[model samples]
Target: MLGQPAQLLEREPYISFLSSSALVIKQWLLFDPMPESDARFLLVDLRQRLPVVSMNDGASFHIADGEPAVASDPAYDGSQPTLIPGQLVPTPVWDDRAGSCNWDAKAVLEVTLADCPPVSDERVRAAMELYVTSQYDFLPRSLYLAMLTVLDGLATGSKRADRIAKWIDEKVSEAEEFNDQSLLDGLRGLKNGSHAAGIRALVKRAVLYLGGSEQEAARQANTVKRLYRVRSQLSHQSDTVELDLARATQLTRLVLNAVVSNPALLNDDAGEEASLAGGRERRTQWIAEAEVAIRRAKPDCAAVEKAIRRPLIMGKNGLLIAHLADRTQWAIDDGGARPVSDEMASEWAALDESFGERL
Candidate 1:
């Protein structure tokens, strides 16, 4: 008579017979609160067929035929069977539900393939700043400044040629110290000294004709080598070496003035016409080549802009604010017409608002 309720067990021949036999014998009690002994005894007989059962009170029982029966933990019912002690069971998490689970398999796979990290706002800002600053710094400031000065001189038709010639002679004399022995020997044979020295003498003659000193003319002659050396170093070296900002500035002034005063020495009208003609045919080809050169110059504004845009939360806003201030200066400098103080201030204010800060 000791068995689980007929309704409690799944339809089976053994369970039906047991339930009917128990009911006829009156040994299966219909107790509201079954005692522990009754529960155990019923579980034992029921274990002969079905090995597990779920009770009405949310409890569970496990019966081993010809052995002892066991009750389950209160927290877990026989609705789900588990491995017995000493048995290896693979516990699987079922995720057949119609929605994404706690761990999305597809998402994890995609992340692995892409190898992308979660981008932080700070990092994004920093990267942006770097790009902007690099663009600014890469511009050829010295070259541009020199060009502007040259253009100015050309416009004014200044009589600074003599001065420039003297400067060149001075630079040439200095450069002689680094000249190759063969060149020096050749100059020396000219007047038993150095090519630089001979060149200086020739320059002096030119200067004399111009009512200037031979010493001044010689100085101009020396300049060609010196200026060439400086330019070479500037173009090739990573380290600044002997050249500094002041030296570069001075050189810029000298070159622009010289070129402007003596345009015939640098430009060939026919050559320029030919180049322009070629460019007209190719359209963007020449422009693309020029862009490459421009980028190589490493201008300053881009670098500054990049610095202003860097991410570190504490200083990011400050950098952006500073850029706004800089933009005001830029506008004033570049405006078609001279900008009044009020206009500059208004521009500054606009930039500040755009960047969400005051410079």
Candidate 2:
């Protein structure tokens, strides 16, 4: 089989049958004899997650080594695999002894990672890195943290409140000179409004900086308010919120990309890198290429899309990898989605009891 022209059969059926959703042989040599060759791949949803055993029966495949004098590539050495192809003879029914296999499931990795733009801003790049790193665990707190970190980084370091107090001071001074009690009382709102630093105010500032209209800014600001409350409950009270992670993740990505486009928003001397780096250091010990790699992570699409420039090889301890699809980031062009709701919290992915422990 090795010498004959590579077979032209459906790659997905066999691959899927062998690889269930739970298993991944990261950095493994696929029955390879050339120990020095460096090549690796991502086999997504291949099989259910399985333990690292000496052998995974489903993943085994056979190829005829031209030298029939001995079985397998004699030049290399490895453990003997169970159930070699075309050599079985025992079965409950004499008519069939080939063992059993179903070839119906179809799944394939179609990579289409677009070229990453030149990331000029330090803060934006840091946020994107955090956002990508959060994907592998597929957790909501990570997504929430990603959004919070990016916003904290890009939020206008300048007072979130417009310098309305100055304008108000001038108006009050003028009214007092004329003894106008009406004007003085009306301008009292300036004291509280000027001090607003909550999510609504911050989100409005970010949206406006991104050139969004007042209505758009208000809409986003409201979303920020609600989501921030959800974030607070999870962080402080250990409460759960019914959130649609897919939609929420898309929204978070949009906010981060907007920050990347407008890096000047966080021109303060101390960038967000300190807190961000410290946060990553505290979490799970490992990071995956699929998590931090720059590419579109669309809603309902768990895979990370990226360009495969060269053969990627990882050691026994390496990041889990995935494939890219479509040229654009998912949902970037697809307009905004519905915000989290009571029904969505239970129906979609939500914070389970263990989420509080992560805090």
Best by TM-score: 2
TM-score of each: 0.17, 0.34
Model 2 segments beyond 4 Å from truth? Answer: 1-116, 157-202, 205-212, 267-359
The digit string of per-residue lDDT tens for model 1 on 183-258 reads 6554333323333333233322322222222343345445434544555576687775453333333322333222
Candidate 1 C-alpha RMSD relative to the actual structure? 34.6
Compared with the true structure, all predictions reach lDDT values of 0.31, 0.37
lDDT of 2 by residue, 61-129 (tens): 222222212233223122222121223321211122132334221211111011112344555655665
* Model 2, global lDDT: 0.37
- Measured by TM-score, how close is model 2 to the native structure? 0.34
Angstrom error of the Cα, residue 235, model 2: value is: 2.5
Off by over 4 Å in 1: 1-211, 244-359
- RMSD in Å for candidate 2, one decimal? 20.0
What's the C-alpha lDDT at position 171 in model 1? 59
